[model samples]
Target chain A: MEGPPEIEKREFGVGEYGRKIARRHLSFEDERKLNEFLRTEAPFYISYSVGYFKFPSATPMENKVLLGSDLVFEFDADEVGLLSERDVWMCDSCGEAGFGYRLKCPKCGSSVRIEIFPDPEREEKLKEMVDALVKDFLLGDFGFGREDVSVNFSGNRGYHIHVRSEAVYELDKSARIELVEYVTGQAIEPQYMFGGVVPCGKDTPFLCVEGPSPSSAGWPGRMARSVLNALERGDRDLLLRAGLKRKDVDALLANRERYTGLIGRGRWPAPKMFPLEVWANIARLTAPLSGHAIDTQTSADIHRLIRLPDTIHGTTGLVARRVKDLSSFNPYRDAVALPSKEVTVRVRIAPEFELGKRTFGPFRDEILQLPLYVAYYLIGRGVAEWSLDSTE
Target chain B: MEVFYEVPFLAVLEKRKDLLPENPSNPPESVLKAASTHLRSILYGKSRPKPVHPSVFFTEANLVAFSPSSFLWERFARHYALLAVPAFERREEILLRHYPPSEVLSLKEFLSVQRPFPELKLYHLEVSGGKVYLGRRAPLFQASLLYRDILRWISERVRNIVVSGSLDDLRETAQRVLAPPSGRKRGYPHIQRLLNVTGLPDGRKRVLFYWLIPYWVTVEGKTPEEVLELANEWISRQGGAKIYSSWILSEAENVRSKGIKPWSVRKVEQIDPELVKLLRGMGAL
Candidate 1:
């Protein structure tokens, strides 16, 4: 298996991997020095922010002045509960970690970090979200060509999509906000996008229009597709299960011809007899699922410092590898940066996780000889420690 | 409140009618001409008009004809500097020349002009006899008054006379100042004052509170802490409403670091008690 080149064993302080990397390798005195460092290290991740450092060096104070930062969007599988089936989440505060999706630390009410166990389903979902963001939003909406965009596996639980277009480089906070809003469909007025009124018989109230136009792009197209899927299902109970009301479902079924005709024309006209609430509910159901769930704060924050591409993720011991082609990129395979040398570790707690092609156990308070990457991953996540005798 | 100030230049010129050349064409025109000439003499040292002070003298006619000495010029410039329409066309040129170009007033520049006045008082008892003065009813008329008042107050306090402009021009200047270079909007004075006092930037402040009828009411205290306490008490009485105090404090810090006027509380009601408390803690307000 392709992996990082072997390095001589060196003792590093606990929780000092980032600092060690910074001290030994980071020399950001000038552009040439920084570029040389970046090239030499070829870090899995590389982040750059102009005017971010107070002292203008690799080692900057915590309170460094950040004037502005390049735009970043993180799609973490943990955030979307991709590893909810079998994962351990530990709270940094109060030391509460266990199997399953724990949003907050039960002991101290702090957010828990997920020790993600790779699941194909979750990984697929993460890929789908990233693909949608890049293809649909970035390329389609923002007019960014494939060359203008770069995708990278975040090396832990997510994907990071970076746009290096000259067009987006100088966008201010408000402009970024506008871009985020477009991606998130924040200011999309359903009434304006989908609402259409058609006159029915005088006895029957006028019908209100809903659903997307086939020609219309983005949410409207996705909405149309979703509506068509529901129509194709043609099962009332299934529609109801999808959060449509019984009355609306019945109305839709009764006027299937009219509805499908409208759908063909890229619209849905509901009988005025149906409550506006029902139409709204139906609209909600038909709207596209949020595949482009971006962190609004990161996008809106013009001065945000983000993870550098090609840098090692300290928590996962995996490389944040940049992907030229997103379609065939598998983070598990491509982003595995650590060497496969086996190492013994005493795991305090670990849920079932997959690394490379093999699966590891749901270990608890057990000393096990594991692959170096797996052992380091556990150690890095603070779920396991190096076996005392083995280290000596 | 309807406010009327006795035209001090007109009053001074009326007082010094004996100083004028005999058979002056128009009394008001003669006063303005004399005042302009006097201002030019002081500024250019009795030299003929050159492009010496383009801001103060837009035309050669203004430099040649209007010299009424420094005293008369000071009195005239105080009120007529902001006259909506100058009584004479030459007067308009002088008024326009006295103020900086509207395009130059960035947020930073505007904020710099806002310093020297710790608090903006709406009705200065001495200036308006405690009754409110009404200027031409516009969106930014009150703000223009506040701007003029702050300039006048600052100039007097510093023993230097800063140039003033008309309500409409001030409004435009504020619009240019507060508006982003790209997405410009109509500017309001009251909103600008609130932004300055609260230490919020132009972008954030414009969205808060309705600009019509100033919502921030005045409170008198010997110290800012005392004023803040009073403001806090008033807010607490409003029933457990959480104001965005932390956000405001962060913004205040940002403004301070930019070397702009630090936060101050001009109106108690517009501020959240928590913000007042934070400001007091930081020694900002």
Candidate 2:
């Protein structure tokens, strides 16, 4: 099979390019005020939804703070290695777009423009992850309620969960660090969740059944229930997938009634006859899935400012719209904010992408007329340039 | 004449080089020397403003006896009580000069009689050969409780001492101690009032007087003129109240150390005029 596609590499003058796009697409008053506000406010740092300005003040205020702080998490198609599977990207340096992973330009070897487009499956997974973090961690663990949390589409690959609670607002850096650690499972000792190792004779192999008590709440309870369901199902393939060894699987199956009895009573047994290696394997596999994959730095930095809701994301030309009902929120349908004025531009490379309710083409080098938002998105990404000599 | 003499209530045990001694009943010269050295170290370590010496009585036989009525005894007995000697050793007597109705008493009686003192408490007692050791027991000082209660206690104690003393003596002592050295000027009216009211005494009172130095300098602004100016400014901004300068200084230091800028008006209100004036003069406002 062919490896990931090579897309060209070139660093665009980010601030200048952003300014150009803002000037062209945004109202003259909006562009002037955004610049003026940025110049005056002078935040510690300003990060666009795309790239960040390390010292925004040094270069004049070009970045705007979203009205509220954002907690962004990315499920990049390229980062998650799903470029070849579902999403597509275009090379900005040499206009080459396709439905495959491209790191460098095929034509000119310049940096590729990977528009952070949505995938239904990946998007679902991302939503589930964020929902669990909000519901289980922020709400259940930290005592935040539904009113305190607001979820938003980041207008690209991820979701932004903004927490606005007076209780959490004044938390210092160290307290925030602790909160991050708890949510991300940093330095969480397995021995803390599972009990100490049982001592068996040096010559004899043993397996220690140690996990959260079945009655315990949160991840522990969830894990316990999942393990119980797996055992009750008694599928050999499931057992194998759970990292049980052949010998251990046979032994467990043979004594299924006794094992089930122990589990039912919430008593984890340390059996000398069972293999210790198999238990360790199962623990290794289960532990990671139990931990919530949260962005620790974003949560830990108390001074961090996030994307403003209802503002347009520079990269995707879609609004970072707030989600009232997170369960039914679809970024593709709901986040489209730009006007639908049709514009014709040279199509370097366009892939089949779903915008609003329509699927637009896998167009090649030919010039094509597309909706204003779509054309602006491609232009902003530097994938397609406005045709100077085009006749409408 | 029955004279009251003060003495060391506790003795340090020394390390022995030889397992067997020439005199089984008495410690060697080297051991005695080491014990004396240890005693000296303890005396120096716990030295207060007024240093008191350990009282010792030498008998015709050159046996040393410690006095239980000395200030040292009172301090030590605040935590410790002596162990009773065995019945066989009851013949050995200790002389008490001023103790009522008893010129002589057995070591056992001495141990039991010592219990009458309220500061002394019963702990463990150990007896080996001819030597006896007393274990001291005192209530543990909880640091959290200490932090909360110490300031209030100091304030109450100082106020009581000030109110009870003669005004003339308090004024004289305040003038003598609170007066700035050489070209340095006297403090403000509030500080002067606080100083004049806080009466001084002998050596012990001087220590308490010095303990107020940090608060005095910080609040009163070194010179009397500057102190008055700052105090007036403070009174203008916030009305005056009975201020505990030390507590105010401590609170300001605490807030400043936390990296908060421009002290809050509420916090400023908690501080006395002297401290607020001092902090304001120092541009910490």
Candidate 3:
């Protein structure tokens, strides 16, 4: 029942496989022709695939090779891959001549995968912050020159600032951490406390410093006078008769937020009524001991406190001297509670923006920096358009 | 006509996946033994007439063998299209004038020479079936004409075998020597089995072979030994050279022991550099 099957023979006579397409293999004559052609063509953006590291700004097409119709390797966007065989080279260090995204080293034949991708949004923010920091503080603070600094997008989010400065490169880990904290104006590690000053006389550091206990430290006049007067009365009964309740006195002695807010704001309604009790509590809290607080509120007297030099741990140093109210501006208690405390204000600033295929910044800048807090706010506000860009 | 038995089982095995022979009990029990006598003749340089089977037949086993997709694509370009063309259907213009318009059009279409690819358009030249078609600068053209090369290799191998006429003489001499000592051997069934009309026709063999080769190489998963043995058997039966066969056997052994086979994309801690060089040489990497 089977019909006769036909068989045809195809034979290439001679000299047919002469076309070489790899850019790496092109002769001088071929290069001239290709250059001429490319000169007339418009260049589009090229997106290549790199497993570990990003390509060096441009496609190094001169070192490239192609596997015939099996793989079309060219300058990234110059070829649209409809053909079954084409692999994009995003990084020069990790392609066929090195460790391709597949994890095999082409030269040494090692199994390694590299990390190279640009983080768009993070790079932008880091660039913004670094530029501001550099422009404001200059590289001297980090022991670096402008030329020694380089910026790279981490290929997902966040930008990495590589300071190749010889001064910074040699610094020990502790110094580097200190410098980073100073430049970023954030809390340093090994201690999680913030710094600020209690308002006092216009010229006083105690007027702005708050931490440990500031009231007990012979923190200067007007502020210290009202505080010490409360303390000098011989008996608690006499101090109480003058003004503050024993409980309020105890709270002030404990350096509680409520007591700090009251004194820092100068809204002590009963300062005269319980003069002795108030001064007594303030005197006890502000006493500073040998490198640590002996008296509760007294040790908080210093505007800046650190276990090491140039490493201030609390909020007392960062705030401007003119900011007399440490009580309300403390980020820990007030700024955080603001949104819930002022829901109307929260709803007003909830608007977001879309820029160049990414969305960010409907929330306040502080909210965006906190790890879990940003995620929580993002989800709570129904903001899915943005994602976190981490540096570490 | 004679090919129905020997040369065509590969394609048939591919089509009827269920009917494939299981691996015989242990090493040395070759599935290639089914076509051993024919294979021996091929290796020893004996011209075979129309085979009892197609030279490379479909097999169900092949359907289960796995190969890289790129490798499969190469095989398709190299083998399937050209072999499937009709033999007797020759255009007088093409045969005599050698620059037939139809052939030029088909070649242009197949190579996609006029397509928008910058490299393809800039580099490739069409010269209407000539010697300049197979040089170093024109790998695409050469690859496209692989069917021609395979067909030519087969025909030349067959001619050499036929001119020697050793298989025909060997069979005759073996018949006389291996004839049964008793005259009663003459009573045994002497007729070769004829084709039964109840199954798939032979005309569909070429199409079936094309589909099966890729499926076997790319989809049908096979252990390294099995794949190497199969490829070895296939190449040898097609009158492939000893160097190619020996290389395949050695490479299969290397992959088995190391687990980091050459021309393979599987990740492993270590791979032999020589294997990579070999693959590159074969243009398989």
Candidate 4:
């Protein structure tokens, strides 16, 4: 569950100022209501429920109003573990560009700071998250058809995917959490498939052990396939990264054909060939690789109010636009909401930020004219002020 | 709970040759050989599986099957952990006492009387005396109890199971089974806040009422009568001008026919004050 989306907007001129935008539940499955809310609350950032309610206006809070929900997955750059450069600050005193958080410019031997923003063009984590949600978990394991899923940029720091089918909508909060756990591979334990021992026979008390066949279902199959992939491609580094020792990697490579064949049939060799722990280790190590960076708490929230499609996210003043082709759609270029014409603004401080085709400032207490989109963005960020001329 | 996968029965048996039952119904050696090899190739080999079922490829074998480990989890949920405790009565007798036929949904079709999934391969393990072993006489297990199957069970129970309890009990059952939390309101401040708004226009006055309702009827899965009762209950509680329940009932009908869902909440706060509240509550001040 989440608190309501923000309806308050802050505009910075001489200082920060507030605009009281009434929170309206638009897009309530009624076209006319959506249009009205948009017209009335046009300029304020809009957020919508991931839930499908009985009364969209009643607000999706109590269990009663929430009829069903759309499966939403979030990929935030801050959470994705990608160190994409946010914004670079330059030392105006020394004309030197800065990279990290510092109070002044290092070029002037002073501390200068760097502000991080998601680079629209180069978020490979987006690709990983997409593949994890759409290809691996949803369609591959859960057997959801392609028509059931939709992927789009979150329009700010990340992307969001919506799995909307009769199946998805019917899922309750626990089931959704389970799905999140499955997709992220958080609950995966290698022991069931590889480590723990189960009886081979009822009569004979003989203990037997084996691993998942490469084609097994669920995480077992996925883990086996991932290991097989590393083995088949002779990815020594990948195997080593998967917690295998150098000698173990060499052994796996040496016995590649036999091992692959055995693993194909749900059998692993005697402990003499490799320690029993190695199989579990392979499973433990590889399951995470199949997992992608998804913000778990947010996605699992059935009562969440997600940013409505085509609405502007307050952060960058960028439209939380749906990306038709995430690979091709650049947020810096396509998601910009304001006009391109130049507007004058006074910057107290800002990191060097970019938009569309133009790069703006590493402005520190300077007056300059920038693109309207850029000015709105700076003001939205609360770093710049618009001072009126006092001629009259 | 029961777990099912689409591996061929014979293939699963191949790993546990000793567990094979006498007078098995497996196809002839030639059919078995061809089908098992094909299934293995479909899974183990590099080639992606075709969209066709294994039955389509090997009509005679019909070797495709689902295996279940246990339904212990479902039983645990059903009996509210009572099944875990030992009693003088037999387990079945105890279960019968708790889930009488009058109260229980007759979802026998899911058990194996119908071919909802593939063939069966039960020979699951027994963990007695801290040693892993198999049952002496392993019967054929049918239901795979995948996540969807569990959901099907929940919905079936909610829609059909006869409950003597009040609407609140039924609603609680739906919430508990569907969401199954630890019953902590700690994680539910958002749930509380969602209904925090009060004293609104008629259209929005029943926000909390609309928020906590549950569906009972089968077709469309939503009933208008319950909507009327809940709307009136909420209306009676309000101190302001009387709001007509007829409007909500008609509104519910309009929503039903139009294929649109009921009302939803839009967010009001700009920042995640919940995070701030959490931080402050933790004595970070």
lDDT of each: 0.49, 0.44, 0.28, 0.50
Model 1 lDDT per residue over A1-392, tens place: 11111111111111235442333212254445545655665543444442233333323334444333445677777664455667788888887778888779888999988777777767777787777677766776455667767777877778777775555555666556555655555344444343336543345565546444555445455445556556766767656765567877887888777666667675456534444343334434443224346666777665444455566777788877888777788777778878888888999888777787778888988998899998988887779999976753
Over the true interface, candidate 2 deviates by an RMSD, in Å, of: 25.7
DockQ of 4: 0.02
Query: Which DockQ-derived CAPRI band holds candidate 3?
Result: incorrect
Model 1 earns a TM-score of: 0.50
- DockQ, each predicted model: 0.02, 0.01, 0.00, 0.02
Tens digits of lDDT, candidate 4, A57-157: 54334523667677888887656655544555555566565444455776687544444554544466566556656766667655567777777667667
Q: Please give the lDDT score for candidate 1.
A: 0.49
lDDT of 4 at A164: 73
- State the lDDT at B80 in candidate 2: 23
lDDT of 1 by residue, B91-178 (tens): 4343344332222222112223323221211111001111122111111222332445434533454322333564334334333332
DockQ, computed on Cα atoms, for candidate 1: 0.02
Model 1 CA deviation exceeding 4 Å by range: A1-32, A35-46, A50-69, A90-97, A103-113, A194-212, A235-244, A274-292, B1-285
lDDT by residue (B176-246, candidate 3, tens digit) is: 32222222333211111111111222222221122222223323435545655665455444344333545
Measured against the true structure, the TM-scores of the candidates, in listed sequence, are 0.50, 0.45, 0.16, 0.51
In candidate 3, what are the lDDT values of residues A183-296, reduced to their tens digit? 333221201111223454455444332222223111222234444344443344534543567885565455545444544443333433334333434433322111110121
DockQ of candidate model 2: 0.01
